[model samples]
Target: MNAIAVRAATPADHPRIVDLLTRSWGETVVVGHGVRYDAAELPALLAERRGRLAGLLTYDIGSEGLEVVSIDAVVRHAGVGTALLNAAAELAWAKGLDRLWLITTNDNIDALRFYQRRGMRIEGVTRGGVDASRRLKPGIPLVGDYGIEMHDEITLEMRRPVGSGIAQPG
Candidate 1:
């Protein structure tokens, strides 16, 4: 198996990134925590295996922290997702950000498990958050993975320790 290489995404990668985002979320626009983000226009990290795009992570940096807008791994369980996430954390740390966070739907059990295993903890659960999100991105499905109804939004976060100067795992 080839090693996954993580790097910052450039303008040339935009089209491919948009395509991937569309395939993953039904479009390049994503709604989370009541805000709409055009994922293709955001700063992104890409993971490649043997020159093929294996995973992508788009994020937004704000006064509070860095928010991961979207993350997708084309080939699961192959370290692609982990590589992308680690790169995002390092980027946040380099920018002096103190926290990394993201919002995922409740029905996305895989994402909840994956983020938790990767050192992020559930920060909050907004009841009926997806219902509010659907007003922006109407394509959001009524049901998601594992035959579960998608309703709430789960916010997860990893806080960088004060004075550590590095992003900490867990």
Candidate 2:
């Protein structure tokens, strides 16, 4: 499999990056979800392979810590998603963040498994977070990629030392 490169994204990468996100997030729901975050929302990073953007992530620096606002990846089972995740974790560490976190839908069993495998622990659940998100982004459907109801948002949290060496966690 070809490898994807992870790096900070510049404004030039916006169009293509958004294209990938559009495909990853499902466009109708994205616009209908009624949640519109302009470019000023956060600093973004992108993963590319063979000069094509494969994934993207956007995060904000918050008083509490670094908040990952959105992460979109394509070509799953390839290294793009994991590479983006590893890079984001490093960014959080460099900024003295205590934890790296994100939220997913209540019925997202796959995401739950993926985060756990990456060493993230479930910290809390935002009951009806997706529903609230839909209010902000009217395009978000009542259900997710499949027919699963999108109600609660599960918050996953993970801490990394000043550096996250690839050693397996004990």
Candidate 3:
């Protein structure tokens, strides 16, 4: 396999990015932690392999930290997701941000494991949070991966030590 190239997304990538987000998440808008975000409107990173788009990660930078609004790899277990995530972390570190965080549904066991293995820890859980999310995006399914009932939102975070520079992924 060709090495994956990670880079900041340019405006020219918007149409493809919007298509990817729509296909992956059911629409361009994603609801997390009670906020609805049009991921296509956010700054993002793109991962390409062999000159083809392989993955994308959209993020929001705030005074508190950087929030990963969405991440999707077209090919699973191909390092595309990891590369996008690492690039996001590096961007956050460059901006002097101290933490990187994201929200995933409780039913997304795969995501929980993925983030945890990459050095993120569970920061909080909002029980039945998906219920409120449904108000914003009714397409959120009643069930998710592994036949699990979707319910809560799990917030996972990795904190960069003060003045420690970039935090490496585990």
Clashing pairs for model 3 are none
Q: How many Å off is the CA of 136 in candidate 3?
A: 0.9
Give the runs in model 2 whose Cα sits over 4 Å from its true position: 26-36, 39-41, 162-170
Q: What is the lDDT of residue 130 in candidate 3?
A: 96
| Model 1 C-alpha lDDT per residue in residues 1-170, reported as the tens digit of each score | 69999999999999999999999888899999899999999999999999999999999999869899999999889888889888888888888888999999999999999999998999899999999999998989999999999999999998887777665654
TM-score for every candidate vs. truth? 0.95, 0.83, 0.95
Residue range 1-170, candidate 2, lDDT tens digits: 47788999887776776666667665412321224464333588888898887878877666655556677776777767678878888887776777677767777787778778988788788777778787677677787655788888787777765345442221
Candidate 3 per-residue lDDT over residues 1-170, each given as its tens digit: 69999999999999999999989988899998889999999999999999899999999998769999999999999898889888888888888888899999999999999999888889899999998999999999999999999999999988886657767432
Per-residue error (Å), model 1, residue 84: 0.7
After superposition, candidate 3 runs with Cα above 4 Å error = 168-170
- What overall lDDT goes with each candidate model? 0.91, 0.69, 0.91
Better of 1 and 2 by lDDT: 1
On a 0 to 1 TM-score scale, where does candidate 3 land against the true structure? 0.95
Q: Which ranges in model 1 have alpha carbons more than 4 Å from their true place? A: none
